[model samples]
Target: MTTPNESPKDKPSSKQMICENESSTTKKNDEGDNVGGGVESVDGQNMSIDDANETGIDDPKGQGSSSRKRGSTIDVAIQIGSGSGSGSNARKKREMEIPRGEPTCYVCSKNFTSWKAVFGHLKSHQRETPGALPPPTFTPTEGSPENNNDDETNPREQLAPTLLNLALETMQKMSEDSNMSVVHRPSSAFNSPFWTTNSGAPVWNNNSSLTVGARAFFTKPGGANFDRERIPERVVHARGASAKGFFEVTHDISHLTCADFLRGPGVQTPLIGNFDLVGNNFPVFFIRDGMKFPDMVHALKPSPKSHIQENWRILDFFSHHPESLHMFTFLFDDIGILQDYRHMDGSGVHTYTLINKTGKEHYVKFHWKPTCGVKNLLEDEAITVGGANHSHATQDLSDSIAAGNYPEWKLFIQVMDPADEDRFDFDPLDVTKTWPEDILPLQPVGQMVLSKNIDNFFAENEQLAFCPSIIVPANAPKCVYHNNHHEGFMNFMHRDEEVNYFSSRFDPARHAEKYPIPTAICSGKRDKCIIEKENNFKQPGERYRSFAPDRQERFVKRWIEALSDPRVTYEIRSIWVSYWSQTDKSLGQKLSSCLSVRPSY
Candidate 1:
């Protein structure tokens, strides 16, 4: 209870305080309001079990005064429910009594176990609220009567130190709850503004709330929205950095595609680039089929059991998918670890059909070559750079844009006729294989310039969204379209129409010119099997042979390091050696010699 040995009849009916054999005189503030609503206490029988159980509202504004109330009583009511010592087994269990003294609410005689909860509860009280002395934040100075003998001073003087301690505790808790760094800065001149209670109308009321305003968390319309402030992240490209810029068409591609942005030369499209494409980094992937993506991610990510990225798990997964060897050429190469965002090359990796105005289809692959040229740090340099700061690339890109030193990339595309698809030794549709640049040369299409650094980090990066139906916001789409299947979650469109559908008469919307969509006459059975021409070894072998002597040695060293994983058994190691042998006999020989495993080849 707030205080003991006070009038039981004075407490609010909600408390239901039960007192026995105690005459309590209800203490009052200087303004004459009863402390704890006239609650009383007894020596051993004024058990405040009700105080510990019944609690009032907790206010986030953090009410209660820093200074102690001029007139207050120090009556603590504590209890431990007990029963007869000897009885039946169930009765004996009930006989045990645990003390629940904890601090009581000075405002309403409610008891709480934790001092943090007590201080947090105190936030509900307003300064003007009756009997809200709040817990103190510190002891009175050494010379104050608080340091004197307990009998020499009244309980109010003794109560000052306890109240001060609680206030200190509550402030510290509020600091943590607000998620503010505790670092002290000499140059900082920041102070918290007064808390708003009723909507956005700044006020000091703890109990008041506007119908559609900022109120307490428990209130109907308060900070509930803040609780769900996080925008969802992309499942795959969750980690990303982006900048705003423009992609200008550098050459005419109107003959190849009817797309608006690529219609003519010198046309620019505002673009946002989020380059956290793990698979995109290498221009090739471990698996050819999109269906294997889930397993690929699982192998690359931490193991389900150990929660560590184990080489054995990755090798084992790739062992079953031999087509991954082509990708391994770049993965273990010297330039595998990117230097930074600005000096990197990118590719579409997948073949997509581009339809012309006449409905002629040509499978195309887009490539990005940095205007600054390809730059790669050696393994040691990369180690040092990453150890210093993992976000070094993001910082570099943002800083470059901010300093007016824009990073630029030239866009190029390779197109092939559908009739020539069967002429290739390797499956052109396989993402694990790259189109030969000599045969299908890259045609320069555009140049992308990242001139502007993002303004809002969350809005630009974390909250970035992608949908098949919607492009990046504010970027003018030369082709007009509508989201006919509209109005679901997060639908913020302002429309008075009751119908949202294609060709709806009730709410008519204009249709854009019909764009040519690709279609093909098919005669094959739908089945899950590797592509017929799975020539997984040729490209990887050619790539390995192209690397210089030391570069080949570095690639072999990386493979040895990966194969040294204790969990990578002899069978899995041999499986890898077989893939390496098929890729390049010399590469496989080096691995077998170093790993001492027989080659499956």
Candidate 2:
């Protein structure tokens, strides 16, 4: 042994370690069990492990802190320390096997070989008093009450601190020969396989009702799943039908759009699909700005207090938004209550940009005209049928496909030149206005047919996601590669790098391959601003005038019913009248005159 004054450099014999000979290998002690065993050094320091443990060693980091020196090869360092008496005693009793009648857990009564492991395993159990719980062991073995309920000292608590310090010191070394830290025997590794709880505790008697005796009532997850007995109804789109089919090109309109998916005229599924115009039966969205969507949803949904969708709330909120008048005109029409999903004409109300392969960009709008023609239900008819089955439209469409009768819709697009954007009287970018079909014309692109019903009703709602191909730079998963600085909702692409990828660490990259950007240049420090020309009056006026005399009366009647709600205020009523008057003079007067005489509901 080296003296306290002796330098490590002077002790060349202790510096270089050698692998042990056969005589120095593992052998059982007087106890007839493998006391000190042979284990491969994880860091390769001490090879003759048993001899080092029998005789004490000194440690530089005091006690329970000496770890093997990590290097190029695995070596077990001979922890040179005069360790504590309790720690040395715990080390002598370290084991890798649990013979019958071993130390059992106070809670679950699980047997353990290493005292350090039992000290660690108790942490997974609760300290408080527990119920008469099943042991959950695969074997129907009964737990002795003396082990749990007795006032006698726990085998774990009596030996816990020594085991705790042994566990702490055992981690200080890396030899499986002297430490049980390297050896692990998890319950799942040896126990019978079954579904586990959220925390991964196994349940043996999973046939919840069937028991060994009559005592197993609702053991863990082995009972009726009352919490999830019925799937809580979908909060949104609660009643809607979905179908599977393909979009086929009826006409080659490749000259108008840049997408290769829309370029081909066949049955191939286009995943990187470029364009989709999100729409409903109406050809206009109520709100102008996307930010107003959340507030609009809050107002239009069922009242937080009443839990019912009140028309007065819808009116009072939208009366402030004059742009919503065009949608109101559609909603008040006889065609407002759609009789069937198959017969409705869907329109993408928003103005979307379509660029040809040659880089010529054109403003466009989308339309889906059903081949089955249009259908509608009056107020009386809708109430009777809807009350019978709230999911009538969903069930009807599914039943139609199962009966071998399919529904089809023809896709059409109205294109306009960006240079000619000023030629239109109404704002082309305004979602509230629809392009005049007479002048712009519906260019037939393709047709979609629902040939089959969806296989599973509760599968993932991975429906066709149709939106503008751009997103905010802040929401980017990675750096945005493209940089034209075109017109997008959240178009801030504030970046320091001119070249995102190709760059040297020391020197900033200046070289870039210049590409032609669109002729429409964006120049402004971004700020909150409305569209320059919000001509909300013109479209609503034109649409109201186009409706038949009887249809116009129905529109007037619906507005009166909406305005007559007791919750509807006089200030909001006047605001809606002023809004409708700007839409059409004759129609506005009819609504104003009707509301003055109508009784409050």
Candidate 3:
């Protein structure tokens, strides 16, 4: 090895060098394939055996030149320093040297004259026994500086090219063994294996919390990166899996909406690093009004005191909201418990208004019909499956994609003319009711294919939030309206403008031209009450009737199980029985007979 301060001429010239050659041993394995016991040329390149032995490069195989293991070689070639070359490549090689440490191998406790020589030695060890040990978990002791951190006593002038290659390969191996990744920090970028409290100030020790003087749990006033460790979980649809795919436009509905993503036929909307069609398994929501959103979530969530979800508590809360009865039709059905995310249908529960470029408004509901057809786990199956593996759903989706069996869904939309809103007995806007498929046929729009699985659960699924709110409409014919109100908790938008509000000269956001405003009149005193046309029982009854007798029996059995809860109030049971009677007398009578109670109504 040549020192940095040494003159190029002091190093042996190319003519004076001779390469040592080593031949690898090969033998046929049990599988009748020739396996080399020594290094083989990578990428089918014609590599000189002499070049390999001279550089002391151990082949990835567990064999090398006998002289390498013994550290004795006389036919080594000398290489000129990186200074011999011009441009950034030379500078990069020079920068790779260990800045201030003695060229020492922490693993073998071997010291070399230069960083390059040390790295070459390390590479030989790695190639000899790949994956024999993990990367250094403990930080190596810092070497005392000989002078200022920049000065070095050793010269690194000879075999610079070979040594640089060895250094890079060894460093790469270290990164792989350590499971390191590049992360952007505020001060400077660095390689890390785990996420810190914040990227800017990394928590070198993540196993323990930041404490005061290593005794108390109180974090150092500003030292601990514990201020913002978590983002609020979504109010609903919190548990879900997301995927990457594209939404292609099959048919043009330019007259319906002006959404840029649906501009024309054959238009594709990329879901990765872009927008997502966040939806649930069922086609409708528990509440139509956003005001009831919080209360509805509270009722569905585990009880505040016990932290356990009880059907009795859920029933008591939703007993008053008859509108929820319709949603329960699907929720209690066999499909309520899915085998996995891919097996169910997705829906944009709310009835959204789609305005065309001509300012004509139409009410549309988005639907995703799974190409696999709807399949649900039976109640007993759900218990057995969930008991076996809570992450079975997530695993199934991942495994399917890995096996090249990409899940697909066909997109369809139900359109209703705003003028025909009151044509049906049920409210068109009621989320609890699904428009009769016979009346409003599902018009084909497009299809979506979940082709890619997310890389990180927390970074992708946990952090991902979608709102019917985050819409972007262009001047395209099918451009749709944008509604973005629920912006809180882990909102990851970086805005750098003075005015955050809209309609300003400096602001870019503004209402689009020819956007149709709903003409429905709003002339009512402020009141808090259920929707007047809450015909929730009718839909549930229809849904119950649509099911086969066996399916209906299962549905009633589920209801009976819920009504039999020890904590369920008699009044609540009576009210529920009365509601079921309104939907179907037979269904009501069956529940009453099972519960040993007379029909309330």
Candidate 4:
């Protein structure tokens, strides 16, 4: 009944309009009577006025009309087209209303105006899937229930068990039982301290070296005593910190490994752990193969002539090893510059064998996840911390232990069944590669807690040593048994020959036959000493792509900046490009773009 040119003042506002063409598309229905209007598509699909109105499409009180109200929001709308009729039917309209005021998030109770903001807030509220709670977000409000509850709970009650407690507990139980009075201790003669030559002897005056005459004929005589004061540093990991802890059995893994440590729950093995930054927080090393380890160290160490570190020279040396790309990506990431020892994660960095009682060997990698979670300092923070305290990490670790805030690490092992190793996307035994956590799930293996600070830093922390070669309990597999046996045999023979000629007059070995020497045999075992069967680049590629789009851009940019150094040669650049291309084509292409030239290789 309304004229086409007349605008309705009662209609909703323009902002609430769900459909703009609702007024222009009105029509009559099949009964030959005008019933509101009908919608007709160019393709000939049509909707009756009544159906459109019910759907809030052609109805005046529906989304299309309500959308123009003072306070309304509509995501969708529909319109009815005018059909030939006695008189053109008026278009119907409707609009949806958006609720006002802040909506409370169901998960965290945070207030948000939109669903998107609320959803994002909920993600932060979600705890880690492993059942560990993140640090509290806010301090308890004054006199609140949380504050009252905190007053009842003593902070000291939750401290991790200490070594002193363990020793005291053992002593107390032993003392309580009368039957445990007699105990045999190892012979004290073996532990006797005698100042002697490399061979056994009693040397009286070690402080003053043998000189010709005290005042007149003073002559520098022997260098033997001076040389004995120093010992060689380890070939790798020259800078490291060691602490005593225990590795406990968390899950039953006796089926996969014959190692004693994994035999059962409640079993604990005394362990000494050492951590080195490996030049960064992330575990990517310079080389994939153990064979390249010596060479890599040689290149990174100071120049033999100057005994000073030269970054340009080191970079030039590593530039030849194209396979080092995977590691370099990690080394250059934000995790590279860690603030202190407590914040970073530790890795075994090498694949080891885990054998079962049946002599079946499975490849495995070890990881130490910090309970505090993985955190790293930016480059600027690293510089500031380093400048203020060169030994900041060492001090932090020592102080934390002294204060009873023991550092904790959860041990996890990624196991690879021998039969399925070949089917994996990357080489399991490759030291330079990382197993994708999504594919090879991390199995819990108890935890290690450093509850006691060493009394003597030199004797315990400094002199302590760790070797990947050391394994105890039957379930642990020996990957290097053949090589170790050979080396041991040769070492024993060499030591025996020296002892036969060099024993002192008081030696018992001079009158007796030499100790029995061990023999080495090759069993021709297909699995022994063999590298793990898998590819290596797939995970590294996945890591690169897993970063947010913005992060990916930054990573690529950082790589280019490093590669663009004038010192990086053309040949090295080509090799690097080729290596990156193998990991990811887009990464390689972006890197090439930064260089302003296509890589020849």
Residue-level lDDT tens digits of model 2 in 1-601? 2324545454323222222221223443332222222332222223232333332121212342243221111112233221222123222333221111233454566766543245446534422422222232322123322344432211222222322333333333422234332333334333446766546686443322222232111222322232232245443344566676667887887787756657857744422233445787888888876545555666787988888999887887787678899888888888889998998999888777777777777888889999989999999999999999988898889898889888889989999987788897767877788888899999888888887777655541333223466322123323225443444634443556444443555445465654434565435533334556789888889999999898888888888888889988877887888788878888777877877632121
Q: Write the per-residue lDDT of candidate 1 for residues 1-601, one digit (tens) a residue.
A: 4345434355433212322112233332233222232231211112232222221211112353333222323333333211222222131111111111225555675766443345456656633443335453443544235365443222322332444343433233323332222322212322237654344455454322222211111223344343243347443556668888898998998988897778899887776532221227677888875555555777887777778989989998898888888888887897788888898998888787788898898888888999898778878998899899988989899889989999999888999998999889987877889999999999999998998877877766665556544544433333444655456754544546667666777767776778887555534433333456889899999999999999999999999999999998999999999889988999999999999998986
Give lDDT tens digits, candidate 4, residues 296-351: 67777787678876655666767666556677667666666666677778787766
What C-alpha lDDT does candidate 1 achieve relative to the native structure? Answer: 0.62
TM-score of each: 0.60, 0.54, 0.56, 0.50
lDDT of 4: 0.52
Question: Candidates' lDDT values, in order?
Answer: 0.62, 0.58, 0.60, 0.52
What TM value does model 3 have? Answer: 0.56
Per-candidate clashes come to 15, 14, 15, 38
Residue 386 accuracy (lDDT) in model 1:
89
The count of residue-pair clashes in candidate 4 stands at 38
Task: Candidate 2: list runs displaced more than 4 Å.
Answer: 1-236, 264-276, 460-520, 597-601
Q: Which residue window of length 10 is worst by lDDT in model 3?
A: 36-45
Q: C-alpha displacement of 55 in model 2, angstroms? A: 34
Better candidate number, 2 or 3, judged by TM-score = 3
Off by over 4 Å in 3: 1-232, 272-278, 471-526
TM-score of 2: 0.54
Clashes of 2: 14
Ranking by lDDT: 1, 3, 2, 4
lDDT for model 2, please.
0.58
